[model samples]
Target chain A: MLCVVNTSAEELRRIALQHFARIGFAGASLNAIAEEAGLSKSSVLYHYSSKEALLAAAVEPAVDRLAEVIEGFTRTGRGAMDDEFVQRFVDLLLSHRLEVHVFINQGQSLADIPAIQRANALIQRLGDAVTDHIPTVRDRIRFGVALGGAAYVLVAAAQWSSEPLDDLDETRAALVDTITTLLADLPVSSAATA
Target chain B: MLCVVNTSAEELRRIALQHFARIGFAGASLNAIAEEAGLSKSSVLYHYSSKEALLAAAVEPAVDRLAEVIEGFTRTGRGAMDDEFVQRFVDLLLSHRLEVHVFINQGQSLADIPAIQRANALIQRLGDAVTDHIPTVRDRIRFGVALGGAAYVLVAAAQWSSEPLDDLDETRAALVDTITTLLADLPVSSAATA
Candidate 1:
């Protein structure tokens, strides 16, 4: 019985995440999500008390993972410029493509929701972690472009591609390479040759 | 007399763009836009028959500018990898930061709106122009990251920053440099050193 309830809840979250990513959270309907999951609206509510609750459930794991990543950065005194951190960040993004899509694009409009607010705060902290060690606004914006850009590219790729990305390994390698290039601190003369 | 009408219309668009960028089109209210612009709701309607029309007016110039950029690419055979094209693209994004923000983050949710649909189509054309010459999926995703990432970073910077970005010249130079690096097709060995 516990297994049955857990499976249903998981199924509902999958459907809900898709809806939230496709349409903004405000535009998604609880009824449509329940119907898609082959359950009554009341049954959907039985598992998650409200639409906000459902959104929280659907996105929290990704949010928590990001939080953990930030915690790791803080603990180790490592930042986004670190190659291992970049790799881990890219992996996290690819794994949670839909949740990141919802958070990046739709999270702003839904900031009144406590879940989204928390996610936004986490993103700010992540930004701080990335930029705190860097001095110039130029370098700061580079980190922003590299990290934010990686998230944007992954989400856009997932959203716009008709078929799933054919090669995840290739995508990951290309992303890491591009981000490393973006974040590298090279002298202007060397950059020209580079 | 013509200038007076034009000034009011421009003012309304300015206010509408901010609202759309900040809260998104679905969450933004026409009434609030009118009030902010110090005009009556009827006057706002007189200029733009519907909320969609207002959105169209607000974003069309930026969309048109991007379309021109893509057309230049097609006409000149200068894809996103070209240095001049990168500079021009970065300039357009910085000048119209808020419009890009609305188009990127909220455009997906408001696809039913004709204006957003047009903007989204332009972005697809821009993508095609960037990647048509590049053979690999990896290169394609690289272009997506560089271009989309630049736009996302700029918008996020604008949205999240408490004060306006202090130096446009530095921002533009850094963006052009970062994008050039992202799009550069360096050999694997040189890339390691670069």
Candidate 2:
């Protein structure tokens, strides 16, 4: 019974992504989504209930996939995640830039929504995965900072860059290099007094 | 004439900060601010006009202070920014946690406001202050990433920490270490090719 509903929801999610990308979260109304999907307004409402709900449905899969990737790192028993892993994570963020854009733009006001809360939890989990390997509190904080920094760049690269980012591959490589350097340098243990 | 206006405006901005910190940017109302400040609604409107306008007044001083700090770095002609400067920066950010929270939480959506736009431009300039000595594009990107990461942690620390962040000093040290590592690890020209 749920499988039948899942199919339609999946279809709606795909359509929602396109509408969101083109018109943004604010501009993409349920009526527009329904019109674009060739579905009745009531049908769309039945599945999504609201615009925020629709956005959550559209963004959840990507968040789930990201969680799985971070989970893999946690299970691997590595002391630190490599640049390749960081690069892969950046790629995921870049691929879902539209959704990321909306989630970030919504900020603290909409954080009470279940989907956004879950996504925030997942992000915390990802941050934990990167920092868990470091034994010292100081290094852990530093790792957290580096991770936060790399993620910020990936999420807001388009806005931060002076020139338009023409080559994403090069951008990815540069970001990986930055994260790699941050992870490689370990502070002296005695100096980490806190 | 402007002197008398500035005094009352300053008082209103101070009252607004307390309201904004307690209730958040979205939750803070102009009426609430006026009531809290012992001013009439019309008086508050005469001074600030809108909530965003009130926010602009409140956040501008902190931005100006930060700009001064960054300007010092730019004039120093140092190869790399020292830990003291970074610590001062971290302290400035931590002290203005409420304003930082509002600015970051607004994200890309409110960036078009003249105050927010000026703030963003100032942040870009700060990134430049640290990286201007470095010639390569990869190093510059890495520098930007570290700066963004440090800034994000500073802004979001209150929310992101699982427990209330009891020790800000430790957090500041850790962030400084992360940024220092990023600056120190400038790529060899050959290694920077991406």
lDDT (Cα, tens digit) per residue for candidate 1, span A1-194: 84745999999999999988766676578899999999999999999999999999999999888887777766676433466767788889989988987888766677888777888998887677656666677777777787788888877766555665678899899888777776667221122113
Question: Which candidate comes out best when scored by lDDT?
Answer: 1
- CA lDDT, every prediction? 0.77, 0.65
Q: List the residue pairs that clash in candidate 2.
A: A149-B149
Highest TM-score against the true fold, candidate? 1
Query: Which ranges in model 2 have alpha carbons more than 4 Å from their true place?
Result: A1-48, A78-80, A101-111, A127-135, A162-164, A185-194, B1-47, B77-80, B104-108, B127-133, B162-164, B187-194
Which parts of model 1 are misplaced by more than 4 Å? A2-5, A78-80, A186-194, B1-4, B38-42, B78-80, B186-194
* Model 2 TM-score, all chains together: 0.71
Query: RMSD to the native, candidate 1?
Result: 4.2
The candidates' DockQ values read 0.51, 0.35
Give the worst 10-residue stretch by lDDT in candidate 1 chain B. Answer: B185-194
Candidate 2 lDDT at A133 equals 53
RMSDs, each prediction? 4.2, 6.8
TM-score of 1: 0.87
